[model samples]
Target chain A: MAIDPPYLLFLGDAADELAAKTARGVAHWRPDRCLGQVRLPGCKADLGLPDKTIDQGAAEGARSVVVGVANRGGVISEAWTDALERALDAGMDVAAGLHARLNDVPRLAEAAARNGRRLHDVRHPTRQFSVADGKTRPGKRLLTVGTDCSVGKMYTSLALDAELKRREVDADFRATGQTGILICGEGVSVDAVVADFISGAAEWLTPANEPDHWDVVEGQGSLFHVSFAGVSLGLLHGSQPDALVLCHEPTREHMRGLPTYGLPTLADTIARNEELARLTNPAVATVGVAVNTAAMDAGAARRYLRETEDALGLPAVDPVRDGVARLVDVLP
Target chain B: MAIDPPYLLFLGDAADELAAKTARGVAHWRPDRCLGQVRLPGCKADLGLPDKTIDQGAAEGARSVVVGVANRGGVISEAWTDALERALDAGMDVAAGLHARLNDVPRLAEAAARNGRRLHDVRHPTRQFSVADGKTRPGKRLLTVGTDCSVGKMYTSLALDAELKRREVDADFRATGQTGILICGEGVSVDAVVADFISGAAEWLTPANEPDHWDVVEGQGSLFHVSFAGVSLGLLHGSQPDALVLCHEPTREHMRGLPTYGLPTLADTIARNEELARLTNPAVATVGVAVNTAAMDAGAARRYLRETEDALGLPAVDPVRDGVARLVDVLP
Candidate 1:
């Protein structure tokens, strides 16, 4: 007899938490735009043959199936594994939002590996885009900024991107690494092959003769540690942007010990951006400061930004307030 | 014609600076007691004929030679290379206190590599060590402390060693890796083999087993950023110390960001010393706060230290005043 499409199954008493987390993930990637309606399966008892629900779904020939197994410690039970395998063998590309605790499920990991499927560790909400032509093109100008991890680089980049859009200027922000790209949604990977490709594309994209547009790139980690400095520098040398904005947290430690923090002060964020013009042999249009609102009081942060901008003769703009577009406008 | 025994040559315009740096290096390893009179070739010459000077040094039978080159931009020069090669060809292990400027000297670096000698980039006066025995036997604990390339790990280690000696303890201090035993002087390379060996040795030489003696080991860079964490943790696990002393600069950035700073405070510096500690596990015995006394007034520094101590409950000691000894004494 013919069977019907398989439905999502949420096991355990805390089904709502699992369903909520799954929804959040779905909303994060906006999967509905690409993948059609996602079905959330309630208790098997609600349907016929409660125990045979998984086998029933597999037999029915589902294209894509999303399942949630609430393993508090991330362990996939033998019964769950059997059900998952049945679905996969039935030609369903299953996606699971298993609790992180399932990381302990060696059998599930092995099963996924063997089946050519993946068990992804879901993290902060992120979006992924595919290049239209399968060609990685270099953006107009590149701006790289990084602070110690968790120093709000993503938040700042988003705020800047929003600002740029508000001002009727087009600006694209990209992350520099695989993890970064996964998080930021708009940057090129500085990995060897991609970096080389981007470097070549940059020559034509950011020609010396043309007025360069700004590309804000955020670097992760310290300049001296976990830094893709070589690759980033290679790109910078090749791209030769009109402006280079280095975002820094105005902390006493970063100031006292780090050599990078010793770079001459900017009169204002705008002037700081402009100073980059001479230092990098390009016209530094303006310097944009992305202050960590969480780290310091607003008043203190504003004062520090103002003093820095005044010293550098640059317009100081907050990523949250002015956005990336206004900041780019301030640039030469 | 009778030839004289070959000796290492040191050439520099500022003999005092070279001498001071060289002396500091020697003191770091306590070479006078371990390696005996390390020859200092006193003379400054252009050595216009680079190849000839190398040949002449080779003509003499020098076991090891040291050369001093002026700091042009914190790097070594080609002239220094000629002299170093001559010493090497003459069968001498070579060392140099070439100012930071000559560090980029390709020739010197090449010659050192070819001759299996060391080219000293004496910019960071600390982080210098000499190996008493070529082999780092099991049970030896080595602690290195430095942030960045030259954050005074060597200086502090040496100072601590000297303090240990003052207490009538026999101690051996040696540099490892690029700055110390592995690159120059005498010891096995501080690579995986050395790391493993250290781990094995630490197990037998734990403080719990030997309460009368202390084995202090340190590392440079953030515990998470470099191989330091693995090697240090291995050593700590292998050889548990009674106390772990962390030398830190209490800047707002490091304090707020580093997880190590969040370690549970020990009761005062002395009580803290009673427990074995690593960056992750070690109960902080004493914190050696390295502050720029020149930048902040002593009173201000004192206040900062007091606040840190109060908040953390671990006694904060200034390296400048309390000294390494008092800090060690406070360790349980």
Candidate 2:
């Protein structure tokens, strides 16, 4: 599903920046596609764009209204009906990554239908996917894997995509999660797909391309994570990446959410991921490391990066602090 | 959802035995659950049970009308509506693994509601599942993992459960797919679940039990199958199995449905599965090999089994021909 841009991001009564993380991601990565921001009265989050009504956003050439705030249950609040309907009436489509479907709200559904606009539920897959074929597609792919969830896989991937394009390379950032979808304006959340079609969805996200073209895929869950290794494995096999950037959070003591599980070493993580990846792309290689050093001081982060590079014998960098040029330099 | 036992099996114009394999599986594994069979006029398959009308089967104490035949596309046939309604009217629930929802058919919905009976769409999970917490539960568990798709994982699991019971071991066959669900009367179709909840559904299926109780989980796709390894890995992690039976089809040259990929060596499969399974269960062991010898002659199969045992240094048995007693003997 291609969500049209420029978007008027609606942060409806979001209590914190984390609630509006999707909007923030879009603004940071695709500022040109973001026309304005619309906030409910009690909203505490901001995307730093001009506040505008739906009519103003439409008049300013916004093509869609993105519900970028995530509530406690990822539900569209009834508080959003007026703004969503207004966006539809103003000739803009509405898109959201919510647990509740936008079409479930009769008023928004009717408004969209009346205006002949689409309602994109980014979290819910609208199309049926066949099982993965494990075919060897042309072109190159670089997938960002992690030692744990939320360890900058997306950040590393986007940075790599941007860096590759800067050097006159044909590259695309393939999103596999909600925030990444908002940033790219289109992508299926691989985690939300049916178990049988995880790899199929990934293959569809990055199809055969020009021989030198690169599809930098955002990864999900760790191979070492008991709760989500399946999603990771499926995505890995489907992505068929020639190069992988391992993302890690150095300060974390245990796996995210699962307090009892400890993180695997970067060596074990790389070795295991490469072994599993050989099923789809036998020439797959771990080219570099992307360390999420947000939890560390600059000195500590630098030390960790050095230690990781020496330990794994890969080019290591914090994609946020340093660019991904080195990582791209060793691309196969 | 518990599908009531003593079923009236419906083979609605099935063109071949393979189409009615689900019915045959139920009849074979749980013969006591079969009351009689209902075949449409052009039905080409039979379960070797007394032919009876829905009303006759209901009068004879059938608790549910099982739509056991799997038609092309897994859709509920229009021709079966008469039998379904008659069964509902006669005070019986209806269970099916069809892709089409039973409640979507107005007549079946009205009939079921009128009779206060339930309609179980076993392939589509109606209940919401949480993300897997990856907690350790008290129970002995055995999981049957395969070398590729359709390598008799469910068959081996069922055989082990039956044999365990015969040997006075407290065990339950935990079904993770549709046919097994019909055989066991209840299970979540783990592959049909949303990708994120694959492991969670598995965890829900086999919860904490008595220390001596064993949950023999039916496995899904292989660790090396590109199309479905995620489902396999999720099942492995969530199952937290102490012992794994490596199931394989001796004659298959390639992975199922994917001509591009070949099967991994049983040694690789066992090692990889054991390594990944260590994420949840560190002490997990590959206890034995379960061979699908249906494609081989008796003497050849026996020799092949002996060779496989020598190669892997594990007990190798065909669950159908030799039972799973040898596999059980090597259990952790």
Q: Which candidate is the best by TM-score?
A: 2
DockQ list for all candidates: 0.02, 0.89
**lDDT (10s digit) by residue, model 1, range A208-250:** 3324444555543322211222223234433445555556565
Model 2 residue runs over 4 Å out of place are: none
Question: Judged by DockQ cut-offs, is candidate 1 incorrect, acceptable, medium or high?
Answer: incorrect
Task: Considering the two chains of model 2, state its CAPRI-style docking category.
Answer: high
The C-alpha stretches of model 1 lying farther than 4 A from their native spots are A1-170, A178-332, B1-11, B15-23, B27-29, B33-62, B67-70, B96-153, B165-279, B287-323
Predicted candidate 1 versus true structure: per-residue lDDT over B69-144, tens digit per residue:
3445645544445655555555555554433423356665566677666544333223322211111222324354
lDDT of 2 by residue, B1-332 (tens): 99998998889899899999999999999999899999988999998999998888988899998888988887778898988998899999999988888889999999999989999999889898888899999999999999999999999999999989998999999999889999999999999999999999999999999999999999999998999999999999998999999999989988889877888999999998998888888889999999999999999999999999999899999988998898888676
TM-score of chain B of each: 0.53, 0.98
Fill in the DockQ of model 1: 0.02
